[model samples]
Target: MPYLLPPPRAAQPQRLLAPTVTHLARLLLTHAPAIPPLLTAILPSSPSLLTPLLSHLLLSHSPPLPALSLFRRLLELPHFPVPESALPVLLRLLARSRRYAHHSFQLLESLPSTHPHLLSVPALSVIISTALCASAPGASFAAAVSCFESAAAVWARAGRSFGAAELNALLRVFCARGRVAEARALFHRYCDAYPPDTRTFNTLLLGFKEAGHAQALDLFYHDAVLRGFVPDAVSYCVRMDAYCKKGKFLDALQLLDEMRKRENCKPTLQVFTTLIYGAGIVRDAARARRLFDEMEQSGVTPDRGAHNALMGAYVRARDLQSGMALMSEMEQKSFGLDDVTYNTMLCEFQRAGDLEGIWKIYTKMTGSGFMPRTRTTMLLMKVFCENGRPDLGLELWDYLIGKGCVPHRHALDVLVTGLCCRDVVGEAYRCFRELVEMGMAPTERAFRVLEGFLKKKREFGKIDEIRQMMKAIQLEEHQAEEEAA
Candidate 1:
């Protein structure tokens, strides 16, 4: 074989120009009024050079305004033709930052009027999804609706409708956040012009089920069937879960039987797990065990989720023996224990106030090299604090740091609250300081705990300092929210 000329290196111009372009972009951002002749000189030489430079600036987590300002300056250049590809990159960059979410929305809203050719389903979907995720919930919802309506008008002008996927994405976001009412209205608004698909119905069903609106979910499920849409596995799962949620196991079982009879809709692992978890919630360990058996018999291998569900049921029923046996079976089957399994056992032990059992699980958890998550850390810290062991709580904090897991503010709240309750004010103050050193502001709850403790101890100087620090944090956060808005 002819020596495959070592996959061609990056063109020399790109390698050389990238650094200079980045420097100039930074220079322009920092030192505004960058020499226009300089940009005109370099950019005109190779218009292609600007694409990577723009992408780099946008994606480098630089403040959005300065980068957008640079883009504007480049736009004024006569020779440099900024690629349309830059639009998506810029939109993504802005969407990712809470501070620039409002700006991203502005860009999205303007696309229909300013760059209608760039208005497509996927581009709109990205903005919708990103806004829903990256901004405050109330603001995100308003922005999503605005973006969708804007895109819908543009699509209508072109004699077309928004794709089902975009509609489903918006529906999913609404449903996920317990905004089923808004989601339902949105679905109905669009369903007439663009017929709803199976996913649309399933999404609504799941949303209603999750919101604990069983009656509404049941009605919606039947309504979808009435509209000639066949219920899929997800639909059946949602319905079954709704019944299970209400502890109407008889109804849930009936639905399961109906699901088995259906030729197309087979029960998935999630379906079984839902039922098992529901059974556990009702303390029906026998039923949960039988469901686990049925799941395996149905040729669905019991994955970590299935095992965890069964374990949770046992924990709920206080059947530690069965839980332990299942744990052994899990290990034997190579379905090694995960954070959920460990957390479940820890919860059970914590409830029973069995310090020995808690220690055993904690040791095993850390030994397994799976770092405890925020919730787990918080739970353990609370337990230790309640048990008069602030020392152990601090040790857990150190372990978390050693594992490179940045403990969340909620965890700090637990540790601080626990310490204050135990009158370990000194340790609590130290813990609070450590968090501040890590550059994370403690939650207001934690701050209040320290403030009250310091006040009680007559440490007026420290209280004033802490009050000042909290005020500064709140001011910074308020400014960020305003910027985001």
Candidate 2:
């Protein structure tokens, strides 16, 4: 009562101004969840305001999950009847956040099929098509395929015909999923029905590459020419990938030149990476390096994949210095190294029998939050054994196991083999026991190595245990053979 007598003016009730769509979009960007009520009130009266707000929400660094709930509520408003218009934006948003894709699919399934908005919005056709292409991990490929089928069926039932853009989206989804036959059939069915565009041919070309049907690609290219569709950048990229796979590097290079001359198509970073990788595989490190430099000079930034391809070229040539130098250059340039790059370098170090170098790299990899994978662990274990550091190998085994980075049976076999080679029979048997406990089936080579060590030491109990494990393994193999028969 005493405090109320002296209440400040700040304590007085203040009127809340209803937020405009623009203001709400800004709030969404700022990640303000408190503005949903204001948003809900304005959405029905001004549906136009919702698009930017929804787009902003979707594009936000940390998007609001509650926006999905708000979107559902907004759909209930009579003025916001065009659900299809919202679909493409929603799909783009879903693609950005995997969690959104999971929730959005559920929301989509809940919507009534008879809703008038389903038929009214043409943009939805594009959304469904894009969603099919950019499917997330939680959403199964089958689910995406089902969604596409449902959308196509819905459009047909509604007597609605899609435009080139929407058809392009559907075609892309089909092509991406490797449904080349289905995509081709749809292309022929819809070719005369709509004006053939660059996108139509691009989809067909991508489908051909995805399916590895090089013959089909030639047919489609010829068909595109007859249909008066000009090949674009995407078309050239698809063809380059196919040509590279077929080891037709000269043909691939020729196509690049033709694309530059006729279509004025500049090869993208991905195109260059594909050629470089293919060249590396064929041990043409010189051409691979040439392409790498050309890619850089052309103002294309080399990504990790490109860098890895160059490293592979160096590795294949057995030029470890050059390979290591490339790794140093990657670090200097602040080009992030992935697990593959680190693993490759580690393998090279192990092969060189440079234990100190391997240990330094191992420390750096672990410190940088790059957990050593099965192959990395096995390589390090082998290095330790060769360097007369069986104790270090045991330490590594324990560390990897503690970190939940348990190796496969093959890796365990390699470690046990390393231990046995060092004549650390007791340590080797201990590791074998741990491997078995970890559910790794010690291979016959691993068992024989451990048994030989135990036999030399006259450890009869350990020998009998090893024999029991061998019998169990043989029994399982026999049972598997019987099942197969």
How does each model score on TM-score?
Answer: 0.68, 0.51
Candidate 2 lDDT score at position 274: 80
| TM-score of candidate 1 on Cα atoms, chains taken together | 0.68
Give per-residue CA lDDT, model 2, range 1-485, as digits (tens): 12111111222243345564434654433333344566666667776666666654443322434456567666676556544556556656655543345444455544545453454333454445546555565573455556655755666655667567666766676787788887777777666765667877887898989888988898879887886777777777788888878878788888777876774667788888887877766778899899999987888999888999899878777777888788889988888777688788888776776666677776677566455655677677777665666666776666554333335556667677777777777877887776554434578888887888788889999999878876775685576446534
lDDT value, residue 290 of candidate 2: 96
Clashes of 1: 0
TM-score of 2: 0.51
In the range 56-143, model 1's lDDT, one tens digit per residue, is 5553334455556656666556546666666667777666656666676566554454345555554666677676787576687677
Total clashing pairs for each candidate: 0, 0
Cα error of candidate 1 at position 248, Å: 0.7
Model 1 residue 92 distance off true place after TM-score fit, in angstroms: 13
Q: Which ten residues in a row have the lowest lDDT in candidate 1?
A: 3-12
- Whole-model Cα lDDT of every candidate shown, in order: 0.73, 0.67
Which regions of candidate 1 fall more than 4 Å away from where they truly are?
1-142, 150-162, 192-194, 417-430, 444-472
